[model samples]
Target chain A: MTTSAIAEALRLHPGPVDLASIETDAAPGFDGKKADGQTALADLGSELSDLQERLWAERTAGSERRVLVVLQGMDTSGKGGVLRHTIGLVDPQGVRITSFKAPTDEERAHDFLWRIEKGLPPAGYIGVFDRSHYEDVLIARVRGFAEPDEIERRYGAINEFEARLVDEGVSIIKCMLHISADEQKARLAERLANPDKHWKYNPCDIDERAFWPAYREAYETALERTSTQIAPWHVVPSDKKWFRNLAVGQLLLDTLRGLDLQWPAADFDVEAETARLIGEAPVQ
Target chain B: MTTSAIAEALRLHPGPVDLASIETDAAPGFDGKKADGQTALADLGSELSDLQERLWAERTAGSERRVLVVLQGMDTSGKGGVLRHTIGLVDPQGVRITSFKAPTDEERAHDFLWRIEKGLPPAGYIGVFDRSHYEDVLIARVRGFAEPDEIERRYGAINEFEARLVDEGVSIIKCMLHISADEQKARLAERLANPDKHWKYNPCDIDERAFWPAYREAYETALERTSTQIAPWHVVPSDKKWFRNLAVGQLLLDTLRGLDLQWPAADFDVEAETARLIGEAPVQ
Candidate 1:
């Protein structure tokens, strides 16, 4: 069967994602023209809305199907921007967004995936995780938040958890918003330069930036270990904010359309009901 | 403060909503021209999209504000269409939609508002209820599903519940999508005539149609008892589907625009960060 060109170009096939081999500035689906790319994004936005409506209807009619978009990016990689500009194009009514910050004392008490399981989107809904369980492996590994043995066990736990979610009808689109150290510096600098952007600036972000090399190594390890056949990780280049948005949007649109969703069919009689309704006296 | 013209025209003020006084086919927010009205609806759709983003950003920045849209109407009154076309214009990532079906055994075990409280949109989100707790008063009363005394207490409970939500920063927009019996008949007939719409056809809907007068009386009683300063009811004339969509869209836009939301300001230093980023070596 013929598939969407954009999905075919961007999808990371089953295997390891070599972070160094991926370009952070690639716009494979767009012409060089900015306006043309934006127009394409707009068009895809409307299609995503339509497909989402059908998906909701399918679920309402008793179909247990769902889409979960896992966004993992370093600080200042524009996860919030993607949430606002790209996926934000679909209706908010049908989407469930979870922004996982540091686990609370109560949350930390449970097993790592405990908080995550509570936030999964129900069948027929689109769920977005601004930061997700992968944080367990990424930040925990890089920050020495967990022991080396515990980190290894988490990798195994995550794989088992995701495989079960897939078995239960969740279609996962995991995108690591990949940006270079230089790009990160520019973004953080921009945040400091603009007073309006200061609210997003945390002094600790600089502390994390100091560990750039270590974090990159941590990400490369995590991607290689977790990119499975059921839920492969797409390393989205984040140097060009616009391209990152477009690629992720197209990835989602393709995944939803691939479901071949249909507007649910009616279950009751038409002709007799029509005749009865027309023949009946006005309720007024 | 001046309110929006469309909002002013469509809002049902403090009084018992006499459904008979409302015109199910009225399009007060549109010009007489259908094409013009459709164009106007499209414009409002985009505006809703922009405002919704800002509202979400406001919430993400720690504003505890929210909007809840309650849609209560007879079957075939176009609740699903509103969800798909009007509200669907906003990004799904920020929306929380709940379509209340009959009470499941577990739900029946709890108070009526138990399920509703679980579905509310958090700060900065817009929550849409296709059908809501008012059913406890409407269907339960008309179909004798609950005792008259129990139904009466629910009205007081609903008023208190809504008042608390408002006090906690949830703005409520309750709308009764009013369609004439003839309009409903035609819609049901159209559903039957189209094979693709078959799944939406529920024979029980026709059985409920037989008790039209009781349902109307029940709705009037519910509206009169629940309409308060904090949560007013807007009886929308929904015989014309396009008009219905436009009216709801306009109401939401006006409500959100009235908030006078501001983009959050940055908290970190700009000049220093810019200098540091520009001076930094490439991590590649």
Candidate 2:
């Protein structure tokens, strides 16, 4: 399949999105087994690295184009895993990663998008947000952390903020890692079984599980209200970790390829510089 | 050889250091050809990943420990290469990399270390500075950006600053990537020869070549003054890119291993959390 077609297959179409209708275990567009998916991801690594370098190179030539990947998921939906396995493919030098946690007193004092605006990648970079301004709509709505009218207003605000970013040359990729409740339970159990993973376990994760339906509704409503043509959301199945990594990797690869980034032309005379370098004396 | 022993061999001892005496192309501690070094580096990737995760895990349990790698070198010394090939082995999410360029007007207004201070990694991060506060001594001295007495004071100030950081649980790995004048010319020529590499080619780099001897002397003096017991410097040969990558990777591995990090124990009852997760109802 063509790269864009593969991306389109994973992309959530505009309108209402039903959480229950999607199969969390199915590898939607990929025609492969676990090993094949791994091999494909490995191949995508080199391609992604090369494309990212071009994107970075353009920045050096004063281009403002950049990519922002916003990953949102419930606890144990493998947001961290995608960062490690998929985003890990490129040069960390060219990537800016921000994992947004609970709002600080200062962050709460500002507009929801204020901290996010500060975290945007500069010219020629890929920025990843493990959780983002979406949290204000996701967790905030579920937990009733904001006023009902305020929560209702944020959806339009987020859409406008994103549209402005797109106009300013930011390509945004939003992925909602979709996993079954059974899969989350199994993953949580594995974390409990492994002593080394104890640091990742939070009792609050269990507390959050009680509000799963509410969170799902929030996600569904958010996806419907905010999945714009400019910045669409891709609901990645996360029951199979390999598929999640592969899908996101492919999506990034397609986005980069779509940009058609070229090696920035030399503004200086290459011949003159080469001659000057050749004529320079070696240090004694 | 033990990892520490390999690290020890690459370290610059406290004494007068001569740039001319060191072979820029030699793989000092590693007994390997290019392919062998590549294999060895690939092996370090997984090991480094595991160690970094453990360090990251420590932060969740309130450990303040972190690692800072300071990279300093002349132009075309492969600092970016090490970041891509060596540091890229670990999860980018866990690594904080800052590439310092010439200071802005605001930065010039304050002490040099002020900018460096702001870039320090928080708990659980492996921070890599492509160029660091060392620039104040090296470039500032060569270019006369600061007064003689002011430059002299920075060395002592740097020692005290680094010592304080060590006391606060930051392990410093400082490396000066050493490359020969001939090697730099070749790399610069290659950049000029390739259109794709034009973005990386800077005319100022050629201008900087004229100050080689001055810069070398500045490096020697800075090394003599600031190579403290709390934060020593390693002079890694960089003409051979593979060895440079391998040596830095090994140095980072050794520093992480020295920390003796263990996964933090669970603060909550794992069994109870598991039971609660298992009993949670599936969202309709």
Candidate 3:
């Protein structure tokens, strides 16, 4: 499939989002097998690198436009994996990635978006949030960490906040790495079985598995309420890791292409600079 | 040559230094043409990635150790190049990079090390400084940005600060990317020649080229005064971008290998976690 189609295919339409109906293992809008998808993703790297440099250059020229990728999913849904394989393709200098953890006392004292605003990328950057504001809605709603009225208020607050970001030239790509409960079980089993991966296996992950249905319902509600025209969520089927990487890579590429970035024009006379450099005496 | 030997060969000894004598185009320890060096660097990627992961995992197990790479160079000397090619080999998530620009009013208000301390990576991270506290001695002396006594004081202060960090488990890899005056002129010319690269060119870079001799003398003094037993400097011959990348890559690999990082043992019962995961009911 064409790269642009990948975004349209994976983007959650406005309305109810029945994540259970989505196939976790399916490579939507992608042709061929896993190897082909990997190859295609690799092919996209150079173009992504060039476009990202253009975006970075534009920042030097006073453009405030930037891209923010928000990734959300259950544990072992391959958030880190996507970060390494997909986002890793770009120059790390131009990318700002934040992996938000549980809020500190200081952060908890302020509005949830305060910490998030601090993490936003400046002009000419591709900002990545490994997990972001959605958690305040997802886990907070699933575990009853907040009141129902507070949770309801957050949905609107988030929508308006995102809308304002979009208005200010921040292009946000929100992705839910959709994976199956069975897949999560298998991944957890693998982590438990491997001595090398022991650091990754947390016991709380098992406790969270008990709330799978509630988490799924929370995701559905979050997706339905906040997946707006300005900033939509893409339900990336992540059972196949390669496809997940490819889908996100294509989404980023399309978003950058949509901007049609150009190299910033030089603010100085090239000839004058070249002559000045040539005339400079060599150091003894 | 062994990677360990790469570090030894490039390491500036504890004595007087001569920047003019070093051949910028020569690959001192690496025995290969450009293609071979490129392949060698590429080959180190997986091992670098594995070691970096282990270092990251050890942090979760309460290990306070981390790695810091400090890169210094003249304009067009490839500090950014090393960042993109060499340091970019590792996972960006585990790396914290800071590019020190001209000091802001806030930074200049306090002692020089204040900003450097703020940028230090936490446990389990690999911190990269594009330019660092040495600037207090380098530019501050060359351009009369600070008093001679203050510049002299900074050299001692920097040594003590770095020694303390080393005492606390931060391994410092301080590299000064060395390039010839002829090569700087060539690179500056190229930047002026290529419209796409104009963003990287600054008219002030041309002005800085006039102070070449003073800057080299300043670098020599800085290297002589501050190459501590704990954090010795390595002069990376950076005229050949490929060798510069390879030398820094090998330096990083050798340092990470020296740490002998191992995955942290599980703090939870694996069997119980597996059993709990297997027993969880699947989501409907």
For each of the candidates, the C-alpha root-mean-square deviation to the true structure, in angstroms, is: 2.9, 1.4, 1.5
Per-residue lDDT, model 1, residue A142, is: 88
Native contacts kept (model 2): 0.82
Give the Cα lDDT of each candidate: 0.83, 0.91, 0.91
Comparing 1 with 2 on DockQ, the higher-scoring candidate is 2
Clashing pairs in 2: none
Off by over 4 Å in 3: A1-3, B1-3
Error of 1 at B83 (Å): 2.7
- A222 in model 1: Cα distance from truth in Å? 1.2
Q: Candidate 2's interface RMSD, please? A: 1.3
Off by over 4 Å in 2: B1-3, B281-284
**Candidate whose DockQ is highest:** 2
Ranked candidates (lDDT, high to low): 3, 2, 1
| C-alpha lDDT of residue B15 in model 2 | 94
lDDT (tens digit, per residue) of candidate 3 on A1-284: 23477887998888898988999999988888989999999999999999999999999999999999999999999999988898888888888999999989999999988999999998899999999999999999998888999999999999999999998999999999999988988898999999999999888888888888899999999999999988999999999999999999999999999898999999999898888777777655
Model 1: per-residue Cα lDDT over A86-199, one tens digit each: 876877667788889999999999999999999999998889999999999988998888999999999889999999999998999999998887788778777777665566
Query: Please, what are the lDDT tens digits per residue for candidate 2 over residues A151-234?
Result: 999999999999999999999999999998778778888898999898988888877878888999999999999999999999
What DockQ does each candidate score versus the true complex, computed on alpha carbons? 0.47, 0.79, 0.74
* C-alpha lDDT of residue A225 in model 3: 97
